[model samples]
Target chain A: MKKIIIASTSAMYGGKYLEYLQPVLQEHFKDCSSLVFIPYARPGGITHEAYTAKVAETFTAIGINVKGLHEFDNPAQAVLDAEALFTGGGNTFLLVNELYNTGVMQALEKAVHAGTPYLGSSAGSNICGLTMQTTNDMPIIYPPSFKTLGVVPFNINPHYLDPVEGSTHMGETRETRIREFHVFHRQPVVGLREGSWLEVKGSAIVLGGDRHARIFRQGQEPEEVAPGADLSGLK
Target chain B: MKKIIIASTSAMYGGKYLEYLQPVLQEHFKDCSSLVFIPYARPGGITHEAYTAKVAETFTAIGINVKGLHEFDNPAQAVLDAEALFTGGGNTFLLVNELYNTGVMQALEKAVHAGTPYLGSSAGSNICGLTMQTTNDMPIIYPPSFKTLGVVPFNINPHYLDPVEGSTHMGETRETRIREFHVFHRQPVVGLREGSWLEVKGSAIVLGGDRHARIFRQGQEPEEVAPGADLSGLK
Candidate 1:
């Protein structure tokens, strides 16, 4: 059975790091005393140790011990032995590249599937999808492949934003970019806005948080589903 | 002498396609009667023919004939023989993938270096840089490499935008993304704002339009350069 929480972001505007998800994480990892943290995504290019320490500070309040995967000599073995797991978010390209380079992407995926309580935020949540094709991050580095965990049936567009009603910026909006992804892919995409997440237990996946998630399926109009809605049928 | 016009966008907010660039393009390609357009980017996932037709409509008004590179049986040969070239904006990954798939990336680069008049907008302009790693487009498809034409010494972040003063979105801002790019790359980057362009005439590259361009160099603070400023010293 898989127990996972894939969140849109670790922090909300005007909030401290992981401030909003702390409560959910407490319950999610209640059965575990400590967890291994994968901090390779290093937001703003922070060092892995620094990023892990920041996550540790937050988990300390929840009575959970945190150790960065980088701190271990055998990261894949550490992931396999973790009581719980958390992957922080930053550059998806960097995350995927480092995961491949460290030979732990598959180990992490297997651990999550083997009933490890797993938490992912932003770029971390993105890898839980079918592919990283829909990520909003710049291609800071080239990964060996775009394939990801596929723990979730569909892809994720974390921190997904709606088009500004009257904006003049000519760049592609989040929706436009996802639609373009559909041009080359058939996977459904979940536009997970801030404050939203997918809660998975065993084979059941449900939407959590107060906001509505925008679901995008190829050849179908995008629809909004409220929190607590079942998302197991996304595929 | 190499001659190129790398623009931030093909269309500005609420403006007709290529309307803002007609006057400048009239002089840029004054010696050419026809130009080949690469519609591989295909913004909004429009068909190559449709995208080309839209561009042809604009160039028609400027007294130049337009033909899509897709219409040619041998794209590489067409690029080598083109009187002038224009690559429209779309997904950077798709454009780069198609350029490599059809074996035209190198030919296009050679043609541009051989002094063929070249015009690029958005994703097209992105390829004029050292690499496509700084592109804002979604990775709809994987390309063989992030390396690009290197016609310019630096990378380009086209359709560059400033952070919203009061927005609550937690996703990385345009500046943050570029800053992250600098972590792994030493090349300078130009954040080309909408309506701004880079006009290259032989060894001289100058910023065009009224807006200032944000320049990002490794290990240094970002600086703003006014229009008409020489950018040949970026490297």
Candidate 2:
């Protein structure tokens, strides 16, 4: 059984990491020993120690032990030590590039499939797909260009949002992005909103968030669905 | 000889079509009686007649009579009737969508390889590459998800430009788009600037334009290049 909780980001507006992790932090890690972070994506480009310390601060605030992945050097052993793993957000492109370059992507995917509880936000949520083609932003950063973890068959369009009124940027709207995706593909994309998330436990998929999920299939209007609902559209 | 000209647009900014057909254009079309116009892409959502007629107006101005594919019910006859083919610009996604839907892409590819002179602008130029993954506007209007004409091994990011300063929108920049493309695959992308184009006659491949061309190989800065330039970078 696969166990993963992929989220949009670790913050809602100005909310801290704890705010975003509140719902899942305790429930998924009641028996976990430590938290390891992969923070190669800071705008300032933080060191692994500093990035992990930040996560440690958040974990300590909630009375849990935490560490950064860099400390161990052996990423596979680091994964072995953790009962659960938490990946923070920065730029999706930046995060994915580092993961590919350092071979952390393969390690993380192996660990998660081996029963480690995987938690990710924003860019971190993005790497869980078969390809990064569905990302909402431009696929700008390139680091070795390896395929992603392949957790799901479809692409992810992260930070998915409705277009602002009367914009002049000359790009397609979110709906069009999804539709264009359909042209290249035949799979259904779960247009996860800002607060929405996908929770995978064993073989079951559950959605949790404040708003309804928008599911887009080929040749149809995207429909809205709620938490715990069966994704008949997905199949 | 496979005669191909990848242009920036059917009509460049502030310029009429065929008004600027240069030594290269004349070199490709010794006789231009049967010209094919593929106008499936409409960012402005213009009709096939309107877009195709606009292309014909340009060729006729140059004393080369042209006909749109829509003038005939069957597109194969349209392909067969052409001494030369000119695909106009609007939206690469829409253009390719219509081509794939109508099965004109395969016909055009066959015609070009069969020795017909092929001329294209903007969206038309984009279709020459392996995929429409890097076109300028978001394929928000339609899916450009065709196998494409495949004259070039790479993708074409048309109307390529750097971002303006003080912009509020946080979407990915043009450079970012190219990099994002590299993340998924190892193909080089031709960042054909507005004035830049490609002229293909038999074994000769020429990059024709005013500005320096930008080519992105995986994990490197986009290298600057020029017209009649060698594109071993593309392979």
**Candidate number of the best DockQ:** 1
Chain A TM per prediction: 0.99, 0.87
lDDT of 2 by residue, A98-143 (tens): 7776768878888887878888776677777666556654323434
RMSD of each: 0.7, 8.1
Expressed as tens digits, the lDDT of each residue in B1-235 for candidate 2 is 7888887654455555555555567667767655677766653556778876776676665567766777778886578557888787765656776788777888888888888888877778888888766666443333435457887777777667766566533344577757756755677888777667877767666788777778888877888887669663466
lDDT of 1 by residue, A78-132 (tens): 9999999999999999999999998899998899999999999999999999899
Ten contiguous residues with the weakest lDDT in model 1 chain B: B54-63
- State the displacement of the C-alpha of residue B134, model 2, in Å, after optimal TM-score superposition: 8.9
Q: What tens-digit string does per-residue lDDT give for candidate 1 at B1-235?
A: 9999999999999999989988899999999999999999999899999999999999998899999999999999999999999999999999999999999999999999999999999999999999999999999999999999999999999999999989999999999999999999999999999999999999999999999999999989999999999998888
For model 2 the local lDDT of residue B38 reads 72
Alpha-carbon shift of residue B177 in model 2 (angstroms): 8.7
Interface RMSD of each: 0.6, 7.2
- State which docking tier applies to candidate 2: incorrect
DockQ for candidate 1: 0.91
